[model samples]
Target chain A: DAGITQSPRHKVTETGTPVTLRCHQTENHRYMYWYRQDPGHGLRLIHYSYGVKDTDKGEVSDGYSVSRSKTEDFLLTLESATSSQTSVYFCAISDPAGGQETQYFGPGTRLLVL
Target chain B: EDQVTQSPEALRLQEGESSSLNCSYTVSGLRGLFWYRQDPGKGPEFLFTLYSAGEEKEKERLKATLTKKESFLHITAPKPEDSATYLCAVQATGNNRLAFGKGNQVVVIP
Candidate 1:
């Protein structure tokens, strides 16, 4: 409950389409992260933003991209959604500079690509 | 890549039963270890963060301990409400990213 919120609690989209998930935070933390959770694979990072306009790839960033235009918002986009992309996406925020390396998460967004 | 492995996959306990969950990790260098609890269809809730070997943290009926290569979460006399998936994660020396374990699903039958 660290003032983090993810949009689109659930969605069903067709394959080969574009999808965007939004993560908004009120804490104004310096770092924000995006992750996808699967049944057997736990949670894997997709992308993260350290500051506004600064982003980096994570462990599973093959087909994903992210952008942070403002301090409070981070967006993850899939240019062409695939069935394998159907999973629950979680947005996390952390403050590493403030000596708090722990990341708090949002409620999450569940996406299904058919 | 930092790797984390959790054992048993799942657990079942009667109310008032005490138990422990294991999390083993391999990283180039350890920065921090974290423990979280997740109810089904919900996000993970932070529980504890252990900074070094021999470090320990506790809350309510739960305690988390860390060693060189692994961590343990002990539940003391758990109740039905204590049932949830416990997740473990590690942050390596050079990065702030966390590598998470598959999590241990716990069921406490009342």
Candidate 2:
């Protein structure tokens, strides 16, 4: 649980529509990451934020963008989602500054694009 | 790129049966290996973290051991409550991203 929560636990949208997912944490961790989990693909990173206003692209960052306006809030936006983007999205927080890479994930958001 | 492979996508065992799940990984330089349990429609829950080879960690009915190239999660006398998908992930040195295996689904029947 890690004091993390994701908004819009489930959503259905048409292709080419825009969608935004929110992740809020109370731990005040330094790192926040957005990942998508699909069958046969485990979890793939989409984007991450190390600090407020500081973000980076990850392995599968193509169609996804993230913004961390505050320490406890990270937002993921898909300008135009496609069917391929339909998957279970997860938000994980970690403070690797302590030398541990273990990430704590949120409940998750299930998205379906038609 | 780091690669993680978990064997036997699905496993079923009777209550009180003991078994082990395998997670093999290939990475340029391993920093840490992590184990997580996921239940239906829920996010992954962190279980243990092994920093280096020969490192071992344990919880109530689960024990995790790590090697240079792989890791094993041994379940001792499993129960129906233990049924869930076990995930293994590896974080390479100097990297903040985790490379994870698809997962191993375990079912314990009473």
Candidate 3:
């Protein structure tokens, strides 16, 4: 958790506006992920980047896009924010070389779409 | 599909009380099971990682054990500060994604 930091710790944006959440890690872990936590539902993976420019969508990637231009930075962007996108976003990183890799999370970014 | 389910949506315990939370998961090949603590308004903090069945890990008043199909987080004499949401997650060998449960909210009253 200490190695990763998410910017814009809290944000309130109007619906249909574009917003971006940033996750920076000091550890330079190879695998980075973006997840959203919501009531009644478990944390859902929105997108993940295995390396810079190598990304894949998760179960809930419909409304989200991710970019990883550098090893230390991964960005999650909402081209059009909506009320349904209001949730706490978390960034996780893992080093696969460590046998059984375990993810470390950031402090999280809380977003509110009004 | 890989899935994880946690029991007891919420638990309220007095100081020094002990209890266990359950997490059941379904995956093709269970690579690793994890336990995390998330306080209100904050992201989840990693606690433990159990790699195989019958394996156990401990941290202070908390102990986590894993089995073939489930894992249990046991708290011993919990304190008020331990009040938070306990989340369970599983990483399957099938894919590189980790599946998480909704989590069990625990409140330890002083």
Candidate 2 clashes: the total is 0
The TM-scores of all predictions, comma-separated, are: 0.98, 0.98, 0.97
lDDT of 2 at A105: 98
Candidate 2, superposed: residue stretches over 4 Å from native: none
Please identify which of the two predictions, 1 or 2, would achieve the higher DockQ against the true structure.
2
Candidate 3 residue A113 Cα shift, in angstroms, is 0.7
lDDT of 3 by residue, A1-114 (tens): 359999999999999999999999999788999999999999999999989999999999998999999999999999999999999999999879654388889999999999
Model 3: how far is B45 from its true place, Å? Answer: 0.6
Residue-level lDDT tens digits of model 3 in B79-100: 9999999999998985678999
Q: DockQ, per-model, please?
A: 0.87, 0.89, 0.89
Q: State the lDDT at B76 in candidate 3.
A: 99
Write model 2 residue lDDT over A1-114, tens digit each, in one string: 599999999999999999999999999899999999999888999999989999999999999988898999999999999999999999999998965467999999999999
What is the DockQ ranking, best to worst?
2, 3, 1
Give the better candidate number (2 or 3) by TM-score: 2
